[model samples]
Target: MAEKRDYYEVLGVGKDASDDDIKKSYRKLARQYHPDVNKAADAEQKFKEVKEAYDVLSDNQKRATYDRYGHVDPNQGFGGGGGGAGDFGGFGDIFDMFFGGGGGRRDPNAPQRGNDLQYTMTIEFKEAVFGKETDIQIPRTETCDTCSGSGAKPGTKPETCTICHGSGQQEVVQNTPFGRIVNRRACTNCSGTGKVIKEKCGTCHGAGKVKKQRKIHVRIPAGVDEGAQIRLSGEGESGVRGGPAGDLYIVIRVKSHEFFERDGDDIYCEVPLTFAQAALGDEIEIPTLTEKVKLKIPAGTQTGTYFRLKGKGVPRLRGYGQGDQHVKVTVVTPTKLSDEQKELLRQFSGTEGEATPQEHHETIFEKMKKAFRGE
Candidate 1:
């Protein structure tokens, strides 16, 4: 009936309207036909149609396809008998643009979210290992307190842009090889805001934002390693036009520990021991992230032997309890010996066994030597 009015006309906009115009008009119509806003019997159907129109018109490629092929089948916008309408940018993009959540332009009339801010924080090894909560002061652009990000002076309000007529864009026709090609671009005078500030806010100089230094406490989670990023939501620079503030990203840098090395969930340390302890066995106290734990050195322990003290390492990042601390033993040789020690070693050498067959620990030569010796 009535040939199902053209989508562009259904939204009451020119065929040559810019993308912003199509979006603005679609938003207005969608809000008007929303079931909650309008109790009309055909509100749902009309809302779907408006959404369909916006979906096709919002994308440059889809709009071009539709412009060339109309509503005819095989038109790229058809989409398996009209099923591909909602697969464009998703409903979130549409909602974010209109509601001021996706970094879009703020309506000189709505509450906006704050802008996201980033800060680099360097922490000591102990603080990152044990966790610390500290406050940092940062200077950023925040919402103006005087005008509340309105960019208007005193009690005045921002007026709609007359050049783009609240569409934030304008069209210009250009001569091309393929006839005339019409293109839309943001208005240069008003910067595509569709509104110009006649009287500016005295506090912010009509920018609707102010620079201020604010202190915010950041919590460093235990087991956070170097280059770890911590996100503090809703703690960034203030938004404009009454928008909410953005998020804060804290990048962590952990200083190296002198005695310990970290490998993921494992804590490693090299413990040095005298040759006497490595040969005769001894209990040595080792340092860990927590308390000092005593480790036993077995007799004949090699220099590279690793001993593990369970649950004595740094805490796991995303799993269970702490990790095991690995202690790598390093044997120290005696550089200077006393005269009594040399005499005692000479006496011990005199009690050594008589001449015997040479034994090879790693080959069949040991068995052959035993056979030649006749036991």
Candidate 2:
């Protein structure tokens, strides 16, 4: 017979390689040499070799025994039976690789937490700017009052599972070419709860919960933006058996405002100004999140100029202070003019050495080009 290769060498890992490293190396080799992917004549044998190496290296106890004795002895406490390394079949190793290795059993009667629930709420724009408290109704599972959440009929209790003896797990032993392999998994008979209800509750029909509509009071904080989420603990579905209840998440959706636009904590709005106001400054009333505020537009202010109103924007959701409001000015020109208004504008244009709008535009464009060229 051909001599067996070193397990670490077969997996291309060091003798002292970490468990994660060993697993990674084994997975890489297994994928490369798998028969379905690689049609090489020796691919199956190479795949088997990789699986064997992983199975032994992944198990602390088996790896320790192999390291000390140079090989595993099946008759000993660690090994399944007296067998050579080549005895390992490919199928059993593949099963172990996919399903996972052995581990301690779990108690089936343990309580499990309930599932969480989510609710999306739409609120007015002003309501998001300022905090509000509201009530909402939601349908969720509540503990069954009829049987006191035991899932058993009145005056009766759940009986321990006979298959797993209330341990909630079962031990499975399989004889492979590598020897006898042992694994512990959840009990099938009791469904891993290690308890069974023979006389089920009539109201819940063996389920420890019942569906009902519940009213919840939620407080939305000031300055909460769209897509914000609030968590309410112990407000979700009731737990299975006697477990603890889960939480409820409230997602907030703020409606759009007609005039105000919000960015972070800052608020912005556009205000139209007459041509005279742009040339000569004036105090104007602008809309803010809470109320209308007065803003001073400086003399000779151009279109698209911004005026700041400190502490007139949205409140900070987390910090102590509020944000400022910015007002963008848009100068409006008269579209229709009276004969007297036109004559005054013509005289004003004559003094400025521009007689027509076309001449004024060309002169300004020429000056802009010269300025840009540093003339």
lDDT of each: 0.71, 0.75
Top lDDT prediction, candidate number: 2
Instruction: Kindly report which residue stretches of model 2 are placed more than 4 angstroms away from their true locations once superposed.
Output: 1-47, 50-103, 349-375
Among residues 3 or more apart in sequence or in different chains, the pairs in candidate 1 whose N, CA or C atoms overlap within 3 Å are 111-242, 111-243, 112-242, 112-243, 112-244, 113-244, 114-244, 114-245, 114-246, 161-194
lDDT of 2 by residue, 1-375 (tens): 687788889999898899889877877787688665689999978977777777778778878877887554663243232344444433346445533544333445667799999999999877988889999999999999999898899999999999988977777876655445556678899888888899999999988779999999999999999999999999999887578999999999998765667888888867666666777678876656655557788878998888889998888999988998887877666555667667876776312112223333344335334423433
Question: TM-score of every model?
Answer: 0.61, 0.70
Model 1 TM-score, all chains together? 0.61
What is candidate 2's CA lDDT for residue 50? 77
User: What is the lDDT, from 0 to 100, of the residue 259 in candidate 1?
Assistant: 67
Worst 10 residues of 2 by lDDT: 350-359
TM-score of 2: 0.70
lDDT of 1 by residue, 185-268 (tens): 687767877778889999999888888899988899898889999998888888755567798999999897666778877888
